[model samples]
Target: MSGRILIVDDDPVQRRLLEEAVTRFGYSSRVVENGVEALQVLRAPEGGDIDLVILDLVMPELDGYAVLEKMRGDGNSTPVIVQTAQAGIDTVVGAMRAGAQDFVVKPIGPERLEVSIRNVLKVSALEDEIVRFRKSAAGTLTFSDIITRSPSMERVIRLGERAASSHIPILIEGESGVGKELIARAIQGQSDRAAKPFVTVNCGAIPENLVESILFGHEKGAFTGAVDKHVGKFQEAHGGTLFLDEVGELPLDVQVKLLRALQEGEIDPVGARRPQKIDFRLISATNRRLMDLVKEGRFREDLYYRLNVFPIWIPPLRDRLEDIPELTRHFLARFAAEEHKSKVSTVAPETVALLQSYDWPGNIRQLENAVFRAVVLCDDTCLRPDDFPQVQANCASRGAGGGQGGEPRIDAPLIAGEPAIRPDDAAGERSGEHAGAAALWKAQGSFAGFTDGSVPFGFLRALDRNGHVQTLECVERDMIVTAIDHYGGRMAEVARRLGIGRSTLYRKLKDYGLEASNGQDAAE
Candidate 1:
């Protein structure tokens, strides 16, 4: 509540108004005339001290959208609310799309302005709490358990902690399979309301017509399927946390109702005469670009602001491979314990290196699944590379030939192909000369078998060493391709074998460069 508020606008009067509003709420405020000035302040050594930004959409030097874009692009997650004298659907949509937390049209009324500021501040506090919780739980949670150690992830954890501590609404953004729901749970677990029920409702999974009833509890005769009184997620999570997963999937009407609930802290049960008050923390997650949806006129701008009081983003796995070793160990331990098996306790160091090399499009969940699969199929005390056949096959197909880190080293021989020259062989032969190259190749892989027409055992050995480390995307792509080829390119069979939707398979095929004929080819 005592945080600094940055006012960014070309108009002095508007800045004064916002300053007064912020001061009235007992917060310190500063005014900047344009995005350039704001960036100057933000980039200062002490710039990060500014807690929230009240940005103006239209300014002389740099507009509000440009300011938001610069801040977000630089990895600054400071909460932002945009204000503009010109009010229009396009303006509101553009502001939100630019990553503004909320948008306020010009001629700002004191009440509306105060409410927006308070909402954004409340959410910021919650995000701070999430960060604290994550830092505290770092060692306890495995990389596979949480999946990120990047600066971005650390910031998200902190923000999530803050969100969990406050009663304000929260919005989490990321791509599909980025573990948005997991972050929501972590927030709930760290909140004061952890003792109470933690309810989750997938907006995308519910029918459009029934979404309201699902969210607002219904009377026995509320609808055709309402045979008895039913409690909605909000009511069920009373005195606790209510997680709205895939919130962007909600219809415009439902979003409006949801906004009302956030504003009033109450809900009106279907077929009921009176509204019932509910005390619950609202946490929402979405993979879709909600601001884009707003720009396309598919989402309400007001609702977007209401839900995004506090926004947290979870980064994809490729950006944070440093955490893979910890994640792999974590998942292996979890699955081993769950299955009451001691044989699958540890992974080979080479396997860890292999996994660290690949990109994890499916993030933590995919890693967990792969570990579980390996555990289930292992026949010996030590889980080896062959235990994860799909992963090894995929790595082999990549022409990696082998190495510990993500990239294949030049020294490694092609085990599946004819033997080739290895760096180690040359290094030993020319001990006095080319020492650096020999060492580099040796550290990367021993190139012994390549010169002799026979493939080196090190190639297979490297695969055996680092098999556990292949990322979920690589493994999944390899599995899908294998299934497709095995089934003679039968789409339906491939989907069934992969345990995914046909549509999902098609999408994966396109993503992995397998859909060459569908005009969805992957970029070269």
Candidate 2:
């Protein structure tokens, strides 16, 4: 919806019409008299900005088919929509076989052209997401997976590559949500253990009592709840990499054990007779400074020295503002596909400017959630600055000398017909549209699913009115119902977007006794 389109045609009138239509549809256009000039633009360094090609199939010298072949041969995967006056089936087949994503007849209607462009861009985004997910799942993810055009990030990548070259203990230092685990995964993926297991343990999330048992394994009957033998994370990551996230949160007792394991290359499981050797690489990350903890005597000085052997500090998102545009586009594509919002193609330039102005305290994770919410709320083909109400309100408040430290304060409700109140306002202050927006903060409680805050308008709740944790089945059922309602009972689209088979969707629908809501869809 918001990309630079290249128009390749020899007819001046056709070229003018196409450019005007593309511009009217909210996309920029570049005109080329023929395929020769089109190829010249695409092969240039700046050609990367061209997102789609509207090539004329019956050109003078280089036809659209020849252009497609040349582009494919040069490893250019930019999508193309070939157009011709001839509407023959053979013409369509030849264009498709030659690497065109879509075909259109000349003198096309504006609506048809717009739909083709949107579909092509959406499919391209989905394909890119699939490739990246496959690579990460296969442990083939590398520094290339990280999206950044910042020099600071490049320096961090250089350090990461150096750390990946050898089996050296690495300590990645970054703020929460700055993608520490991603960097650790990239290190493991680039190392010799590419296809091996990459186990992650959130040191901060574990209970203090189970830290040792979880890290060093436990034999059956080792404790009151140890009814079965358990293999600890270290053993589970044997022959691969063990990523200890938030390593600074490890208890002092566990720190000593970890230090011993690192030094001796072995661990003694609970109730074990002898120590078992481990052959896994260690990659630890922490948002807190371990040296400060060591100074405060909360962390073991010796263990700190051992873990900080090759420290890599990743700068926060605010320091590298140049990456916001690229990151926002990436998140937009991914969430658009997942939410089935094909119309939400690109972010407006004003939205980009607003995003870059605010310092993302929650970093990339917050940005991702923001885009997801925007896509869900968007009714048009593009995301405008108005879509990010929280960010807009934050910027307004900052100008008025209020609200800092990444806490979002909404001046108004995110959507129409919602009751909201300011955080500082008195208890019975809930009112209509004039009331403040959802002033959500960065927390790890009920909103664990989202980084910034819980979903707006109570789409999903982790707890009930009685303040108890919701059962998994109950939550899942509610989620499916919400999605069904959100997507208007389009069963196939719902199932595909939810990443579930139709049979499985039907089963869940039957179990929830909601099949009658869409009997027509269920019958199919």
Candidate 3:
């Protein structure tokens, strides 16, 4: 591949020498005695053809740094390799910050210079291809789907919109269930590249042994399970976007490969003879402080800097309770129809207050699951406190005094020896010590009630009443009746929601004298 090279130096000998070196490397060359002359030529309409520039730092009539600063300031991204007799760490860093692609020391080695030029040019070419492929019009799904009345969320959506217009890698930081992935999708959806693939991978979900092949692909017969050739994520996301969720869980080895792919703009699949180039924007998310991992020497510092280019922090639900009503209503409408409970369309005001009272430790996802559960339990048009016993229990517990561990908090603790599961235990997840209290969606009634025979959230009657504080039996019996109504007299569904057994549900029906009401009169 032939190309054009621009050589700038005040020393005639050095200029001629660099010109000859570039020519010997099979590229046409232009030599100027100083940076001023080089800029004049570089600014010409024809200057756009220059593939690379070898700039000497100490030139008269405008030094190489000035020309580089001007070019970058004017948005000229043409690759430039700065040549200086002094290649100290500071000089290299400064030149890089000034937009130089790379730096070469005085009395440069031919092989060294060639390699730098080649790498820079390759990156430039990839960036150019990205620009050419970039869409002229943005997609319709721009940040409008992130429903919120809070200013915090509005600002997040605005920033996300601006981010979508570029190809810069984005890092989304937030607690679990704060919807990091949702924000990522919104960014990708709003961008010009929305039509392209928006591939997502959960770094923590994948087994450690297969992470490499998953990200970098595998050739057929490359490993024991390699029966057919497979493409990796980078290749799959070419001309699109790649989203890595829970990125902090990536193994150190995989992190190294990931950094190389991002830095080199390519990937070498498992057992491939050569690396293949790829063009894709990156979006990484983590619920933990990755910089802390870097400090602990678990993550690469260089890679940390690379992925931290654009940071967007998503606030947890507790910080944005004002948006709960909107989010609740959205989910209420969605899950009610989805679960075939169309009657459960609106949230009662007291229920919203109950929701806002407890610290939603599990964030938005937990809240969403809570709403789904409430909708399933509801048989009436409006959701009531009875529909969310746990929420009421939590509010009461927090109101009395905070307690250790997860919810089902109430006026009193469970009997010392009762059988119960932690919220995370029911969901089959360990607490994230490194993951900043990460919480997953916990299914309602998954924890079951206490073994000594108590209703879940037995304290709800204290807060809810029909113009008067009702007894526990009234609340308990009403729940069984509503469960039966909602499940269409299906004992199994009723039993599951009430956290009791089918036989137990039958006993309750007979005890409550609703066996006939729920169509079980014949069996009774």
Candidate 4:
């Protein structure tokens, strides 16, 4: 909070007066006779703690402009305020162009000088805050730590690494909870500006009316809530990256403003007379297909193109099933550490297989929740199948045979609408058929075709062959069943584990008919 002010002036009286004024304002001040002395002071580590430089434009040797240029060229960002007797519009412009923050007429009043110093320092403080915020936020990113061995996910990881190394705008596309933001963070970590700010704003979270102000800032009195000047994400992310999560959710009007900012490298804070120049890298992520949205006229094509300069598609967890074991272990470790319980470690192979078999509708987020639930419920060192009751239930319902032993083939569906459950007549007829023929035909088509013959095997096989197989509903059902089993029939536990409120989970359960209990085991 304490700042040092350096006064560089040839006029002895002016220097003394300014120093006295600065001292009264609770700031320590140092006086140098000319720019030469100021430069020397700045170059020397032991000279003084100089936070702001009040320099006179005209000096004998090494004038203020030359000193300013030198400091900037040397990459010094110390705020400079120019004070001169021969002050004109051209002189003010010249000082600013030379990197001086502000200009003041030489016959300066004590109050005006103090105000200028306070204003400059205030701006500097904001800039410092922005830098601090970015560093802290960037450090919070642990995306690369996401353990995944799947080739699909490995490609995403490689893309994330490349994106992180550059300031080019990156757009991450995938299903919700697929770790789009994680990819964004990973990119930030690999970037040259890693040490600077990395800020994230959920485009969908902000109200449509206020998103523009949130992205580009607003001048005081810009709108109804504009009681104070607010710094937008662009300004806050100066010299760093700004991640717009769910950018596809951003309203069209705001999209235009955002596109302008990205293209022009400047932003007009609402109600401001002039646009402020900014330097920042844009990173956007969305669960929605932005290109599809653009074609549907829901999102702007221009904005999409601008944001899509570097597109990274994060494959859904289903597509990267091979990574489940690694991701499960990672989340388990994370939750154990977070919960301060080192005793909890290792998951049963049966449990791992159950997780791998699951179609993660919520993607990495759902997997994380499942692991966290297991960690909380698991009292032993090894996570048993019972630790993930919901997952077990889902596997059982799917007739995937939960656990390694494969219990007596229960006809119960692991999840509602699971294709594994067929009519008694259908099962009886299939019993006579050769197992190899059944396996071959079943393996050749979609999972949906394995149950009801009503689903065309040819169509399902075509889809499976093309690799556009899994349905979102199927994934959702699996996720729902997994959550339920993890909670041991406790709706509250299921909701908490899945990161949704209990009421929401109940609604989903009812919608999916997952709330239907067998009614055989009540008190057990």
Candidate 5:
């Protein structure tokens, strides 16, 4: 739910006021003096990151309407909230027709503005999620749809891309909830057989007696339960991709038939007179190591070799910590929209830090459920550490290197480890969140201290040493330091970015004792 907002207004006072309101509401903001500057920011490569735009109708060069028209014409669907001094119906209708998501009158109340922003972001997130899922179900999902910022994942995508260029069997190896099936689907979506039936079969979930019948079509009266003819998963996926999930769990007897199917590109039904040829791509996934299963004689060696032609091993969530922030934001937006939690739109940095500290044994799936629960139960606009008691407890337990049975020691700021769980919690915590948890992954290395002054994104410490919220002056000073470092000591750029004049910036720099460290101003 966290997003950067772009504020476009000719009035300096209005821009400053809007920036402060946005910051106070736990969002980041950028201010542009006119529509021209706004478009410059929007059209910049970085503009894609802006979540919402608060536009003023009356501008010197490019007006709000013009900006909106240009944005829609260029297919830039970024959400916009147009604000004007005039509250006339004509203005509202015109804004909406021009593709503005919402309209606000000048001097809008803080509460009204907050609500409008939340609703707009929620709708946008839900719309995007719907479109993505529709594409996935229609067998058109591509690697571009996969979200990951981790280098390890980049390698995986490169391999998948290479594998997709031809009909080589791919075996995706990963822990449960690590998105093995998603990788399979993306490969199919990118291959020549894309848009064809991408049928899936959970090999482990089917009864052993029916495995052959379910995978290879059976004729009527083929078996006692075969009262009618039925097309099997393999036949249904003809000329497309057949994803066999949990392939390591396939019964030893069925492995022989699966091996034959892959070897000869054909399948023999349970009681068919002739073997049927199938022109389909084969993609298999497993949480267990197929090699280990092969060594144990649980899986066939030939089939293992065939499926392992192109192996893609996805790292667990604990190894991709950098992706947590973006993944959390994605889920926060989607779940908030689905659950109608209009007020829950962002997570406090401490909450994110606490989440990053935990070891997600269930991987991305667990993190997705954790965020969904937090959003559903959160009553405020921002999620704080208090909102995640279970996560905090889990991290504390793991940090101590033991679980409930360890010799416990008294600790300050005691928190109840177990939060009350509702019966409805079952539905929200399922692994289906894996589809979107697509981006959530494990930290690359051991857990790092969040307060060691190395936290990513240069976030100021949320709480003071005494565990209380830091004062505004202290936070302001840290923000200036962060800005100085981010802007490479360009005082003018810092002043402009912070929405302050040169005099005010210098005054604050001196008051905060930052001048000496920032003496080498690139643009004094």
Candidate 6:
């Protein structure tokens, strides 16, 4: 009732009737003459914001079903109510299958349409509210802002929650960048002792001679550096939680003292006659296999059993690459403010593709760092591959190292919302190697126009050095053909990423004699 309604119909009388109904419902309306025109209007930048669409069943060029199919295929979830003269069950079922929220029989009643629209809008609002509450609940339950929908992470979080309320020592195992400490902190934060201090100690970073003093504290004049009494991490974490990161790195001698502390809630200070009593919830994390270390006598078997009461393994980022987009958007919002560049906060589709392509060896931390770096370097309102020089350089080096099947494509030109034309392909890659495809693809489809607009330095020098020159028409033609190859001919995304209207993008595809992926000439 508060948003614009799109009325798409071929009949002038029917269109006017629907528009009037829509306006009377306390909403603004737009009237399109046909389904083909409706898609054009919907794919525009403003089209993304349309609240709902009322599509007629019959139309020339494209029908309501076809439009629904296309919209669904493009990942657009805009609510739609399909209107048809035929009240056949089959038509309604087909419309539903194509993602129509509801169907209306023609000779439209104002009450019926009003009821359906209100119901659909009510459902949408409810779904949004549910999502908002779920996010709030996730934050409160986990004591974390780590965003993920990965099934593996969901299981880990659930397990960590149960582990939090108990007094058992928790052992967290995973790769270095897999966010083990976050899990430990979540447990600490959600525990009964949440108000108490939660201390962390890196076992591997401590000097070999100071291990005992660091973990158990020392009395004044305990050793050469004992001019004053020192409080250790374990003492600091008394009545709270102690997170021992890299716990496997503890020396064999220190393992014995740690095992004693777990066996008896007490620790002996260096050069002290009495052992001090302490109560702490222990959570240990390591990137290494502690069982193997125990087998090698580097860790005490008794200590291992004591610490392994609750085991939680955090899955690596590679195992959950599906979460990258969500994580990227979250990081972009955060880093954009930190960098003071709001315009460059949003990433182009090509940047996402490139990010998804890489095997993130350093995991989430690395991805966040890379995004931050790209945000700092971003010169335009949107982030592009050019902004991530380190990532590009890394891919280039990997390609140079020679990979299987063929040489790696380090500098392939990536058209946004497209598959990717190979580096060796003459269509788009070569032209975009220096300036990047976003720059070349953004042009009114010409090399001169690309270079003429602004001398971004890198692309121009690379072009001049490479001795690559081209005419106006070929630039546009090649761009269209190359875009089809890269995107597998997904015209909607190609148009969106190429910064051109869908109609304009399609006409150029027709002019170029290339549109379909089967390599057929579009003019035919």
Instruction: Evaluate all candidate structures by whole-model CA lDDT and list the values in order.
Output: 0.67, 0.79, 0.71, 0.69, 0.76, 0.71
TM-score of 5: 0.70
Candidate 2 off by > 4 Å: 1-50, 58-61, 107-112, 405-524
Q: Which rank order by lDDT, best down to worst?
A: 2, 5, 3, 6, 4, 1
Clashes of 1: 25
Compare candidates 2 and 6 on lDDT and give the better one.
2
Candidate No. with top TM-score: 2
Cα lDDT tens digits for candidate 3, 355-452: 87756766888888888888898988677888887777556655655432333434344433333322221210123221211111111122333234
Would you list the clashing residue pairs of candidate 3? none
Error of 3 at 379 (Å): 1.7
Assess candidate 2 and give its lDDT: 0.79
lDDT of 2 by residue, 266-367 (tens): 999998889999988999998777887788787899999999999999999989997887788778889887888877887777788899988776788888
Can you give the lDDT of residue 202 in candidate 4? 83
- Which runs in model 6 stand beyond 4 Å of their true positions? 1-144, 393-524
Backbone clash count for every predicted candidate, in the order shown: 25, 0, 0, 13, 10, 4
Model 1, position 457: C-alpha lDDT score: 21
Winning candidate number (lDDT): 2
Model 4 per-residue lDDT tens digits across residues 207-271: 56778888889999988878999999999999888988878777778788888999999998899
lDDT at 305 for candidate 2? 91
Arranged by TM-score, best first: 2, 5, 3, 6, 4, 1
User: Candidate 1 or 4, higher TM-score?
Assistant: 4
- Model 6 has an lDDT value of 0.71
TM-score of each: 0.50, 0.71, 0.53, 0.51, 0.70, 0.52
Q: Write the per-residue lDDT of candidate 6 for residues 262-337, one digit (tens) a residue.
A: 8899998888889999999999998777888788766788889988988999888879876676677566666766
Residue-by-residue lDDT tens digits, candidate 1, 404-494: 2222344534544534433221100111232223332343354433343333222322232344444667646645654454344556434
4 versus 6: better TM-score goes to = 6
Candidate 6: count the clashes: 4
Angstrom error of the Cα, residue 23, model 1: value is 59
